[model samples]
Target: MEKPNLFSIATKELSQDAFITWLLQWADDKYKKENEHLCLLGKEFAKSLIKLDKKLNAENIKIAKVTAGRQWKNIDIWAEINDDYALIIEDKTQTGQHDEQLKRYKKIAENYYKGERKVICIYIKTGNECNSSLQYIQDNGWYIFSRSNFLAALKAFNTKNNIVEDFTSYLDNIEKETNSYQSKDKLKTWLAAQGFYLWLEKQVTDWNEWNYVANPSGGFLGFWYYFTACKKTKGAEIYIQLENRFDSGIDLCIKIGADWERTTEHLYKVYGILFEEAKKFNIEITKPKRFKAGAYSTVALVKNAFTTTSDEKLDLEKFLTVLTNTENLVAEAALKC
Candidate 1:
C-alpha cells in the first residue's frame, strides 16, 4: 500500500486557523533537526526578504523567535531575526488581502516589538485575484509572495520529511492548475478559462467564414462564434454559443438565426441535420426552440458536452472536443447557405 499523505489531506479538511497553526509550528526553530539553534524556516524565509528588498542583510542568519496568532491581534505570522529584524507575514489561501490589512498588521508587529526590531510586512497569497491590493501593498513597501514563488521557496529548503514533501506537492499542484486555467470553480478561474477558450477560437476559426465575439462583459454568462455576414443566409445564421450557468449543465447551443421570413423549412432541415450529427456522437440534443420571439431562428441545446454539473466547472479537454464538433457542424451547414 502507498503511504497516505495526511498533511495534504489536513489542508483540505482542516480549518484555516488549524492550517496556519501547523505552518507556524514548522516555522519555529523547535521543528528543526536536533541541536540546530537556527530557525530553518526563518532562514529560508529571510532569503525571500533579500529578494524583496536588497537593502536587508542576509548574513548572520539567526531567527530569535517565530510566533503566530498568540499576540498582536491575530497577525498571521511574526518572526524576529537576530533580535533586530522582524518579518510579518499575512497569509491568504482563498481570500485576497483586504484594504489596509497588511498595513494594520505592520503597525501591530511594530508596536509589539517596540523599537526592538526593524519590521517588514509580507502578503502571502494563494489566490490569483489581488489587483485591488497591489497599489496599497506597493505604497506600504510590503512584499508579496505569489503561490508559484512560495511553493518554489518551500521546495528549495525541504527537510526531506515525507509530510512536508507531500504538503509541498499539494500546494504545487494547486498553483499549477489554478494558474493554467484548468480549475474553473471560482469566477476568476472561469474567466481565465474563457480567455484561453477565446485564444483557441482565434486559432481554429477562419475569420472569413466565422466571426468570433466574446461576452460584452465578463459578467455575462456566455459568448459565441457565428458565421460572418457573407456566410449567413438572409433567413438563418449558423452559430454556437458556449454558456456557463450555475443552475444548468454545460451547454453548447447550436443555433440557426433567422429573419421574419418563412423559415420553418430551413429550421426543420437544420434541426434534423444537427440532431443526426449529434446522435452519431451520442450527444443528445434538447430544448428545441423553433422560431423564438417570432424570429425565424431556431436553437438546439446540447447538454453535458463537458460536464453534468450545473456549476461553472469546466473540463477543458472535453470542451475542446465539443468546440471542434460544433465548429464542424456549423461549417457543414454553412456550405448549404
Candidate 2:
C-alpha cells in the first residue's frame, strides 16, 4: 500500500518552504489553545529549536509568533520567542548553497531585524553532507540541523500519538531517501580506498599518451571505473561483472552526456572503432542488447574480457592490464572522432 503524505504536497516541497511554514506555524503558541494535541507538536518543535544553541536558555524562552516567506528578505521560516530572541531557519532541498547565500542571508537578517532581540540563524536540510563546502555557514554562527536530528527529536517527543505518528511517517520517507544516497557515498569512499582506483590513477600518470584522466563518477555502484578524454569527447568506463562464483568479467563501455547529440550512425562509427581496437589486443567485442541499433547517450557496452580461476581472490594485475588496454583503445577512438 502506498503511504500518504499528510500535507498532500509534492515530495520535492516536503523539505522546502512549505514544510518550514507548517513547522513554524505549529510552533507558534497562539495556535496552542485551539488544539492541545496539535499544540504538543509545537512544544516538541520548540524543544528542538532551543536545543540547537547552547547559549540560549530554554527557561526564558516563550513560544511567541511565527512568520514565513516574508519579512527579512524572504527567509524560509522565522520564529520569535519572549519578544527578545529571533530564530531564522533556511531550508534547502535538492539544492546546494549558492553565492555565499547563507552568509549574505545572515547579514540581511541581522541588519533588517528590529528591537533589542538576539538573532540566530539555522541552516536546515534533509542531509548533513553536501558536495559544496559549508564551512562558511558554520563559521558565520549558523547552526546545522539535518532531518535525521529533527526526526530523532520528534520520535522522542511521543510515538503512539496519531498526529505525531503521521508526521513521523513523512519524515521517515525523507530520511530513507537520504540514507540511500549516503550508502552510495560510503561505497564510493570504500572503492577509492581499494587498490584498483589508486592503481588506475598511477597508470594514467605513467601512460600520459592516452590523454585520459581518471574519474570516479562511473555509477552509484563501486564496480565501475571512468576515464574522461582530453578532446571534449564522451567518457569511457569499464564495469566489473561477477559470474558463476568463480568467473569475473570486465565490460568496456562508453558514456555520452545528455548534451552530446546521439545518432545511430555516430554510435555505429564509435562502436566500429572500439571493435577494431579490441581485436588488435586479441579482445573480442561483445554486442550486448543495449548496443544494438538505438539512440542512447548514457552507456554502450563495446566489449567483454572474462577469465576463469579457482582462487577466490580477484586477479587485480590481469584485470588492470585489460582495463588499461581498453582505455588506450578508447583514447585512440576519441582522437579519430
Candidate 3:
C-alpha cells in the first residue's frame, strides 16, 4: 500500500504555495550545511527563474530572502536574491488568472522595485490547463512554469526527505489521473475530458477558442474552430463546436450566426450542404429537432462523433480524419452560402 499523502487532503492553491515557499526557504545559506539536498533544489529553482531573464545570470548568486502569502502585495511567492533580482511567482493549482491579475501583479512588483531591482515574473501552474489559457498567460509577458517542467526539475534531484517524497508522489499521482483518458476505455472524469480537449487543441488547427461550457445540469469541455464568414448574412459567421461530455458521448455541432429569421433560413440551407458533404466521408450530420434562434445557435449536431477502435477505445487517428473531413465539408458548404 502507498503512504498517505498530505497534498491529497490539502489540495488548495494556498497549500501548494506554502509547499513552494518552504522549498525556496532552503536556498538560504543557513540551511546549506544542514540539508544540502533540499538547499540545492531550492537554489536550482531560483536559478530557473534567473535563467528566464537574459540580463541576469544565476552563477555566484545567493538567495537573500524568501517570502510567501500576503507579505508582498498578495503575490504568491517572492524571492529576493542577492541585491540583483526579485523573483515573483504567481502560483496556480487547477485555477486560472482572473480579472487581469497577472497584469496587476506584474505592475505591483515593478512599482515596488521602482527599477532598483529587476523583477522577473513567473506564472507556475501545477494543474491541467488548456493551451489557449497558457498562451494567454504568455501573451501577458509572464513566463510559464508548467507541471511537466516542475516535475522534470524535481525528478532531477533524487531526495530521501519525507516532505519531498510525499509531494513528489502526490504530484505524480495527479499527473497520472489527469492523463488517464489515454488509457481508459471510456472517458468518465472531468480531468479526462480536459486531457482530451487539451490533446485536441494541439492537433487541430484554426481554432479560435476553447473552454468549459457551463449549463444548469452540468458543464462540458468545448472547442470552437473552422470559423467561416457567412456571405449570405452580413456581420455573421459560421463555426464548428466539439462538445465532450465523457460518458454522454461527444457532440459535433454547427453554430450559425445571430438573428432568428436569417439564422433559421440559413440553417436548412447549410444543413443540406453539410449533410451531403459529410456523407462522402461516411459520416452523418442531422438537423436539430427544434430550431431556436440566438447568437450562434446550434443548427446541426453529429451524435457519437468520435470514431472508436475495435476494443472500444477512442481511435485518435480515425477521429482526426473525421475532423479534417468535417472542416473541409464545412468550408465547402460555407463557400456556397
Query: What TM-score, over all chains together, does every model reach?
Result: 0.50, 0.51, 0.91
> Candidate 1 on 193-229: residue-level lDDT in tens?
4444434454454432212234333333455555533
Compared with the true structure, all predictions reach lDDT values of 0.57, 0.53, 0.76
Q: For candidate 2, what is the lDDT?
A: 0.53
Count of clashing residue pairs in every prediction:
0, 0, 0
> Which order, best to worst by TM-score?
3, 2, 1
lDDT of 3 by residue, 1-337 (tens): 9878889888988888888888877777778889888888877777766776666666656675554343468788888776777788999988888999989999999998999988888998888887778889889888888788778767768768888777888888877877776644436677777777777788876855677788764777788888887666566667889877767766888887744345566678677877777777666788877776677677788755676777767778877877777777777776666
Positional deviation of 90 in candidate 2, in angstroms?
0.9
| Residue runs of model 3 more than 4 Å from their true location after superposition | 59-71, 184-186, 258-266
lDDT of 2 at 31: 77
RMSD of candidate 2 to true structure, Å: 10.7
RMSD of each: 10.9, 10.7, 2.3
